[model samples]
Target: MNKTICALAAATLATGAAASEPIAVTAPGPQGDLAGTLIEPAEGKPVVLIVPGSGPTDRDGNNPMGVNASSYRLLAEALSQRGIGSLRIDKRGMFESRAAIPDPNDVTISAYAEDVSAWISVVRARTEVDCVFVLGHSEGGLVALEAGQKSDDLCGILLVASVGRPLGDTLREQLQSNPANAVVLDEAFAAIAKLEAGEGVDTQDMHRGLMPLFNPAVQGFLIDMFARIPAELAAGVEVPMLIVAGGKDIQTPVTDAEALAEGQPAAKLIVIDDMNHVLKPVEGDSRLANIATYSDASLPVHPELVDAIASFLEDSKS
Candidate 1:
C-alpha cells in the first residue's frame, strides 16, 4: 500500500463519554485522489472501511439527494465510543472525491468495488492491521460483495440496509411500494425490464417524477447494476459476513437481508424492527414519517445497529 497523505485536518466526534479526532485521509485514484475520513481508536483495534450508498453521498453520509441525516458519520462516532475505529469515504467522482474522475455518472459497480480495494490497502497501511472489515450501506453493500469476490484481505463483510436481490428487481419493488406511483408503475416496470435485458431506456419521454431515477446520464451505470444479483455475489464471498436489515425500511426490506443470509448460510443476519432505511428509528408505518428522517441530521443512527456490528466483529475474531 502506498502512503499518499495529501493533507490532514481534525474532526471531533462528540458521542457521550468517548470521542476521537477524525483525520482526513486520501488514496491514489485514477485521475486524482480519493478522499475519506478515518476515525482510529487505539492501536490493535479493529478498523472498518465504510462505503457510501447510491448517488452523490459524501463521506459523512449526507448527499444532495434529500439525504442530510449524517448516518455514516454518526455510526463512526458510535463505533469509536465502543472502541472500534472506522473510515467512511465519498464515492469516486462525488463530494470531496469529485476530482477522482470526470463524471460520477460514468461508473459501474465493478469500478466502485475496485475503489474499495484501494481503500482497503490504505486502511491497512494507516492502521497497521492485517485486514480491515468492510461495512457497506445500501448499494455500497453490493460493492463490498464484489470486492470480497476478488480479494482475500478482508476481515469480514458487513451489509447494512442492502438489497439482496438484483438491482432491477429491487427498483421495481421500490416503485411499486408507493401508492402514488401507480400512475407511472407500468412505464417504470417497462424501463427496468429493458435495463435488465442490457438495453437502455429512452427517458426523454419518461414521467417527470421518474426522470431523476432513470436519467440518461446514469443509464449506463443502472444497466450495469441491473445485471448484478447480490445474492449470487454473497454466495461467492469467502469470508465472515454480517447482514443487518431494517424492518421498517421501505427501500430494502428485511427480506432482502434474509436472501443474502440464505445465499451465505454461514453469515449472521440481524433485523432491527424499528429502524428505517437511513438507520434512524421510526415509530409507525406511515411512508411520510419514514421519509422525513432522511433529512433530519439530529437523529442518531439506531443504537442497536452499532452494537450489532461491534458484537459481530468481536465474535468473528474467535
Candidate 2:
C-alpha cells in the first residue's frame, strides 16, 4: 500500500486541493483488479464513488479522445474540501484497470452497473461506512441508475451532465447539431436507427470520421446503450437522486435534467448557468470556445456544481 501511495502521490499533488494523501485502492473485477484513487475526508464525513463517463477515460477524467480535462480529479479535491471523501476509478480494460478484461469495448451498461456494485462494496469495507454515495458524470449517470436499481447499499445518486433520453436520440441530436455533420447525417442517423432496433449496421465505406464512433468493435455496446432510456431508468431508481445540469452544455442540455427530474418527481435538480459539458464555465455560446475547455486542465470545474453536490449530500443525511 505504501508503494501504491507513493506512486500515486505525484498525480494527487498536481491537484493541490486534496485534504489528505490519496490512497490507491482496488475493487474486484471480472478477470483482474479494478484500480482507483481513494481520498478520505475528515473522519466520519460521507464518501462518494466517482464513475467515469463513456470512452477510454481514466480515473482522473482524462482520455486519449482529445479530452485532457481532469474533471474527476478536480471534483474529488473540491469535495474533499467540503469534508467529502471520493474514489475515482479507471474502467475495466482501460488505463490502470486494463487487465480487468481482455477488451474494453466488450462491455454493456449492465456490466458497468455490476462494477459499480463491486466498487460500492469495496468502499463500504474500506471506509467502514454503512453506504456510499454514487456520483456518475455523463454516460456514467446511466450506469449509476442501473446500479441503484439492484444495489441496496447506495446512500444516493448524483447525476452530472447526464442525458435523460435514449442514447440513440441523444446521438442523433448531437450529429444534427453540427452543420459539418450534414454530409454524414443520413448515414449516421441510419446507423443509430439500426442500433436502437437491436440490429447492427455495416460500416463498410462509411465516412472516416463516423467510423470512430460506429466501429464494429463497439457496435454491441452501442446496441446495449441505445436500448436504455435514462428517464425510464431514473423512474426505477428508488434511492434519492440529485440531477445536475449545465446551462451552457451542448451535449446533454438542461432539458435532459428536467426530463430526469420529471421521471423521478422526488429527485432534486440543480442547473448551473455558464457551465459547459466538461463541467467548466463558458462565458459565451461559441461551440469552439466551449470545446476548447475540454483540453484545459487548468480550468477549474464550476464552483456551483461542487456547491450543489456538497449541499445535496449534506441534506441527504438529514
Candidate 3:
C-alpha cells in the first residue's frame, strides 16, 4: 500500500494513554479523504479499529440521515474503560472527508477493504499494541473479514451484528419482512435480479424498481461483496474469532452469526438476550420502537455485548 500524504483533519497528539478526546487523522481512501479517530490506549494499550456498518456514517457512527446514536464512540469508551483501545473511521468521502470527493456514491467493498489495510498501517505506527483487533458492526463486518484476508496486523476479529450468509439472500429476506416496504417489494426483487445478473440497476430517476437503501454505487459493491460471505472469508483466517448477535437483531440476525461460526471452526458465537440489531434492548414487537433505540445514546449497549468482545480480546492477549 502506498503511504498516504495527508493534511490532518484532527491532529495526532502525544500517545501514552487512551485520551478522552479522539484524535482526528486522515487515511488513504478510494475517492476523497477518509477521516478516523486514532483512539490511543491508556498506558499504550492495544487498539482496535471499530468499523462502522454500511452507510454514509461518520467515524462516530452518526449519519446525516438522522442516526445520531454515537455507537462507535460509546463502544470505544466501553473498550477503553477495559484498557482496550480503538480507531473509528468515516468511510471514504463521507462527512469530514466529503470535501475530498466529487461524487460520494461511487464506492465498493474492494475499495473499503483496501482502505482498512491502509488505516492499519497508519494506526499501528502510533499505537503500542502488537496487533489491532477489528470490531465490525453490520456491513463493516465484511470489511473486517476482507482486511484480515490481506494482512496479519489484526490481533483478532470480533464480528458484531455481521451477516453470516450471502448478503444478497439476506436482503431478499428483509424485503419480504418489512411491512412498510411491502408495496416496493417487487422493486426489491427486480433490483436483486439486476444485481444477480451482474448488471447495474439504472437509477436515472429513482424508479419503482429502486430502493433508496440501495444506491447504484453501493449496490455495485453489495453485489460483489454478497458473492463473498463472512464464512467464506473466515474460512482462511486462523486468528481468535468472536461472532456476536443480538437476539432480536432485524438486520444481521443471530442466524447469520451462527452461519459464520459454522464456517470457521475456531469461532465462538454469543447470542445476547434482549439485544436488538443496534445492540439496544427493545420492548414488545414494534419494529419502529426497536429502531428508535438507534438514536438513544443514554442507553448502554447490552453489557453482554461489550463483555463478550472484551473477554475475547483479553483472552487472546493472554
Candidate 4:
C-alpha cells in the first residue's frame, strides 16, 4: 500500500565476475515448482537467501505492480563481493513461480515458511553448505522468522524494514498516515477490525481506493497475515537475529524495530539514518521523492546497508 499502482520499469540485472552461472533451483510445492536463483560464489561461503517483500515481487526484488528498486539484485551482488553467495527467490504463485499455484491469493504465512525451508534444503544440498542465512525484507521478515523457528539449519536472520507489531496495528497506522486516505479512514478501519477478528469484510460498500486491499480474493490471506503478531513471533526465535530499520522508511517505522528488539532482547538492532524501505539513501523527507525510488531501478542500494550485513555476518561467524 505504500506504493502507487502503476507500470514499473524493468530492473536491470547485475553481473558479477566472481559469481557462478545463474543456477536455477526449484522445490516441490503443493501446486507446482517453487523457483529461485542461486548465485554461488564458491564452497565454504555462507549462502544468504533473500526473501522478498509482499505483492508480485520477483526474484530480483522488482514487482511489475510498480516496484522496480532492484534492491535484492544489488544485495546479491554486494554479498557476492563480500565472499558470500545468495539465493533470491520468487515466492510460490509469483513471477517465475506463477505456475506453482493457480491462484496466488491461496497462500498463507505458514506456506511461505514451508517454501523457505524447502529453499534452505535446496541451497545446502547444491552448495554443500552447513547452514544458510536468511535476509527477509518487510513481510518476508515474518516468513524468515517463522521458517527459522521450524528449521535448525538457519545461521541467523537479517530483517530489514519489517514489522514488529501485529499486522492489524501496522495496517491501521499505515492507513492513518496518509492525509489523502482520510476520506475512507472509517471504512478501512472497520474492514481491518473485521479481518483482525477472523471475519471477512464485505467490501461491497468499500471505497474505490480501498477496495483492492479489502477485496474478497485476498481477504483470506490478509486475515491470516493480520493475526500474525511479529513481536510475538520474534520473541520465540532461537537463532541469532538482527533487526534492521530504515530511519526514513515510511512503511514500517523504527519503533517497530525497537519493539522487535524489546521482544527478543538478544536481537541486534541497527537503524540506518538515511536508508528508506527500498534500502536506498534518500536526501529529502518528502513522501513523493521517497516513493519515487520504488520505480527507479537505476539508483544503487545504500552502501551502509551492505556494510551492515557484511559486518553482522562476519562477526557472527564463530
Candidate 3, 49-133: lDDT as tens digits: 8888877777877777777778788888777666666789877767766655666676667777777887788877766458788
Candidate 1, 159-267: lDDT as tens digits:
9999899888888887888799999999999999998999999987789999998898999999999999999999999889999999899888899999999899999
Better of 2 and 4 by TM-score: 2
**What are the runs in model 2 whose C-alpha is more than 4 Å off?**
6-18
lDDT string, candidate 4, 1-318, tens digits:
012122222122454235454567787777788888777755456889999898888888898788889999888877776567889999998777888898999999999998888888888887787769998999999898888776577889889999999888998999898899998998899899999999998877678899888889999999999888888888888888889999999998999999989989999999998999999899979989999998888898888988888788877787
Q: Model 3: which ten-residue window has the lowest total lDDT?
A: 1-10
Q: Please, what are the lDDT tens digits per residue for candidate 2 over residues 218-238?
A: 999999999988999999989
Among residues 3 or more apart in sequence or in different chains, the pairs in candidate 2 whose N, CA or C atoms overlap within 3 Å are none
TM-score of 1: 0.92
Q: In model 4, where do residues sit more than 4 Å from their true spots?
A: 1-17
lDDT of each: 0.87, 0.88, 0.76, 0.84
Better of 1 and 2 by lDDT: 2
Per-candidate TM-score against the hidden true structure:
0.92, 0.94, 0.87, 0.92
Model 2 TM-score relative to the real fold: 0.94
